[model samples]
Target: MGKIASAHAYANNEVAYLAWDIDGKIEGCLGFEVVRIYLEPDGSVSLRDDGEEDRVPCAAWVGFKGQRNPHWLPQTTSIWPVQKLSWRDLTLRKRRNRAQLRPSEISVRYEIRPLGDWRPGLEPAPDPVPETVAVAKRGADGRPVLDADDRSVKIEAKAYDGKPRPLGYLGPAVATNAIRVTRWIGPFQSTFTNGVLAAQWLRNVIWEDGVKRPNELMGMISDPKNGIRKYLAGDVLPMLRELFEQAGSFLLALYELDDNELVDLLLANKNRIRLILANTGLVEGEWDVRNSHARQALIDANVDIQHRMFNNSTHIGHNKFVVHLDDDDAPVAVFTGSTNWTTTGLAGQTNNAIIIEDRNVAKAFADCWHRMLNDPLDLPTEFDDGMPDNQQGAPFRTSNETPARFTLDNGAKLEVWFSPNMPARRKSSAIPPDLREIYRLMRKAEQAILFLAFYPGQSGKDCIVGEAIEIGRTDQRLIVSGAVSSAQAMPNYVPGRKNDRNDPEDDEEAVSPHTFTEANVSIVRASRLDDRDLLSDFGGEELTAKGGIGAIIHDKVVVIDPLSDDCAVIFGSHNLGFKASYSNDENLVIVRGDKALAAAYAVHVLDVYDHYRFRAIEAELRRQGKKGWSGFLATEDTWLDPYADGAKGALMRYFARG
Candidate 1:
């Protein structure tokens, strides 16, 4: 059927035109540059060149209203104009009249065909072969034969030779073209391809290359921040806390002479056993001896206490309790050295002991303990065993016997030897004879004496300090530094003063100024001014002092002529105080050689000394009503005024006069 078309202008001078092309005649007109086009239902057509559809009317176009018959026809209609004109002429009459026509234009026409023998308003008979329909038939055999409809079939399949062109392997080229076509339809194609898509593709390729597998990749994606929170919260705090605790515990255990604290800790736990002993034949205070009431108390509580005899004639040494572990064959712990298993040693006095947790190290110490425990004849003792039948009257001949030697991991060899034996004499209960030997060695220094201690007390009460001063003033040059006194307030009368005189007459007697008399001794107060320079000029020098917490030179050591023609650093844990040297149970190892350790120790001591000196000076200045003198006192001269104006100066001058 043909359709009528129309175009009309509104009062606002607007017009619209609708076009119809029932067959596929409008396909050629579709292009990328075309702005807008709409197809109508009519068999006719209309055109608008101004690109404004609302200004034109659809009714103004011819044949747009279906002017043709509605019934089915015998043949398809063919509609075409005698001539074709440009779009410009189609809109204006003058332009259309001036346009020339050609035979080619007239030949460009449309054709449509109808079904055969079809009449309008009547049902058509069914054809034996319908267009594009497949017919199924059942024969006697009950099998269906399917045949394709003939009218709708095209010869294009046959037109192409038997060998149809294959899509084939376009490879990356085809993929690239397909991607481009897809990207043209959306604005986000560049972002997806270049960003996430590219990353995902690379990741897959990497996995294919065997660098990583898909499972590992998925695990990484699931939880990337694993263990981070726990590590920050728990592990770090506990590790650091334990480190500091161990450091403090080790230092305390090494220096404290008494085992009360350790004993208490072990006893409190109930599963462990504890024993304490002092070398036999060495006279000790009433509290330190095995028969003392204090020792009996611990024995009553099930703690073992033994005494080993070390007489001049006998070759006996104190037994050391060395703990060993079978698994690692190392020392799990070792309790040895000069510290006594007493309450004072554990709580009040300064002493040295080693607690090695390594099982291998413990085994080595155990070996040493076993060697020391054997019969006097089996081992080559350094001194005479006092047995008449023994060869040379001694366990081992000093000339033939090899000295006890130890080799450290760094390949340094240390030779141990006993000092010459002294005459047997009446023993005193206040101090042990072996300790007196140690004191004699410390006091016999001719040129220099350097002492490092953790707990130093006032002069008279501190036997080591008194002896050190006596020797320092008479023969040896002394340098003493350590943590003296407790966290409590300073004691009255500085330290070593006897309140009761042996004779009241002597106390009343006035002495001449020139006469030499014993007086109380105190540690030299270090000046605040000395702290500013850090004693750098004293580096590698012969004389120095160090004392403070965490100071590297912690071991109570005494070095004589270190790094000078003669050098030695006697170290262990014997505080240069009366209690540590005489009254309290203590231990000290005197090293007559080893210049390198001596020098390092000397330097370390000076560093600590400088620190203590600064603190002392600040304290003295503060006592003198001088606030913030630590900032002002930069030179020794500036410190002199404050020192003289305060009680510290009097004490220092009094000691100097003595």
Candidate 2:
């Protein structure tokens, strides 16, 4: 016999040693065997047979651990016959027959009642096992298992309520065990990268559109309630703050918002006073309160507040107010933006702005500002000047002659002065000596020519002169004119039709030829001077000519020899019309020698003209063709470049015919 194993248990006041071989052979069998039970903290009861120091087959009962008495020993001899059992087989049988056994141990011949589905009446029944064993139950409330792993005899688990719990319980200790599992599963890396890309894209689109809205998709994502709140509040906000602070005066203008939003913004930034001026029509009705509030805030802050009203018909004149600061002899700054100071212009509409730090540019804008503020040409009738009726007709006076003339830090001086009545001189040949100086300068230019006017043909004589100069120039002659028009002049209309011969003569036709008068001859003259082809159909039968009243050319500029190293002429507002040159209180400042400044003025003039022409062609094509010609016309391309492609080429071809 290799090593006999014997189990002894106290039962019926008798001690018996049941002997079995290592191979599970019943070498010898004695009386009752003694089996001692040791309870474990894991809710398991271990059974050890005496006389087996190696504990060759120590077994532990796992399921339903509680105080109970052993049942099998009492009827040990009642079975068919004694049968030996291996240690492995004993453990396996205990696990399989967990429901049939009590939370106790016993030693007996294995053939007794065949453990499967056999209830040992002598032993107390084992309690029912928990359906779901919480390996690590957390919190005092509901059970939430974080994770679980099952391996036939063993299980691992974990749970998280407010805090994490890492502990577990064992089951079927004789063959099965339990363990606690832990892991980390969250998509942090991917989410962070995606969020960064989204933020960048949002910034670009917002800047391009010049609009901002709280309800937009990106705005929602940046809201405090969203999961990305931390990102917006912490990283994004801080980054924007740094960028805005560093931006100084270069920051572009933001689009306007609704009145409610404007109020909210003002409240949020109560320490800072905001100034706004806009056309009333562009704003919502509710903005009146906001505008009033803004004006009051500026007054309280001891800052100057200026409001200029304009109608929708004067879009170019409406938003032309510019601000210049410091350097009385030289303007150091210029402010231009889409913000109209009205509730709607500042908050609702998308606008863009630029602030030029150059002194010359600033001075030019300041001059424009003073002219608009002082000139009574089109101001509201209710304006008060604190002057008596006798002196009301006198020239306006201000504390300063005008905003400071511009002189650059780089030794360049900008001469911006008023030439009252040059337009009148240009429109009508009633030129005084001073007014004639403007025309004389235009005649003196040598290399290049540049003209910026709102309505090119409003001054008939200026049109003729400009056409003559264009024909005379050996170099490029750039003409910039406004395209915004209220005139309903018919296209391709043949003039010269006095009346319809076939129809009966009406009362209008019955009037004498001497009683009839041309409504806008100046406009016609200007058009003819620019495009000589218009003069060809001057007196045809199909012409339908009309005039624009209260139509004003707001721009005042004329640059000659702009690209050359020699001379240039800049004059305007007093158009080439007779009234502008003689009667109107107009002014024009002529710069004779500075080629560099003249070139800059020329460039600016050309830019406005190119934009006007592009928009005009687009609008006209849309109106006349009605065949979706707008799309082709609206495409943007460099006007200064060769006109050999697309609509630009078409435009060049059309002009070339003239």
Reference-based TM-score of each model: 0.31, 0.33
lDDT of each: 0.28, 0.29
Clashes of 1: 50
Angstrom error at residue 639, model 1: 10
Q: List model 2 lDDT by residue over 192-249, tens digit each.
A: 0011111122232232222334444334332334433232222222222332232122
Candidate 1 local lDDT, residue 391: 17
Of candidate 1, the 10-residue stretch with the lowest lDDT total is 170-179
**What's each prediction's clash count?**
50, 50
Model 2: lDDT of residue 33: 18
Report residue 349 deviation for candidate 2 (angstroms): 13
Q: What TM-score does candidate 2 get on C-alpha atoms?
A: 0.33
lDDT of each residue in 1-658, candidate 1, tens digit only: 2111111110000011111111112111110000112222342222457644312110101110112111101111111111110011111111111112111101011111111122454333222121222222323432233235322221211111112111111011100000010111110100000001111122222232223443442233223142211111111122222323331111111111223333444344322332333333323321223323434444567653333223322222323233423333333543343333333232112233333233333444444333323322222142212222221112222221233444434333333222112222222335534446546666555445554454454333334544666665664224333333332112222323344588555443321110111232234232222323221211111011111211122235555655343455554334444333322223333444544444434443433333344455445545555563322112112222333233232222211211
- What is the alpha-carbon lDDT of model 2 when measured against the actual structure? 0.29
Cα deviation at 339, candidate 2, in Å, is 10
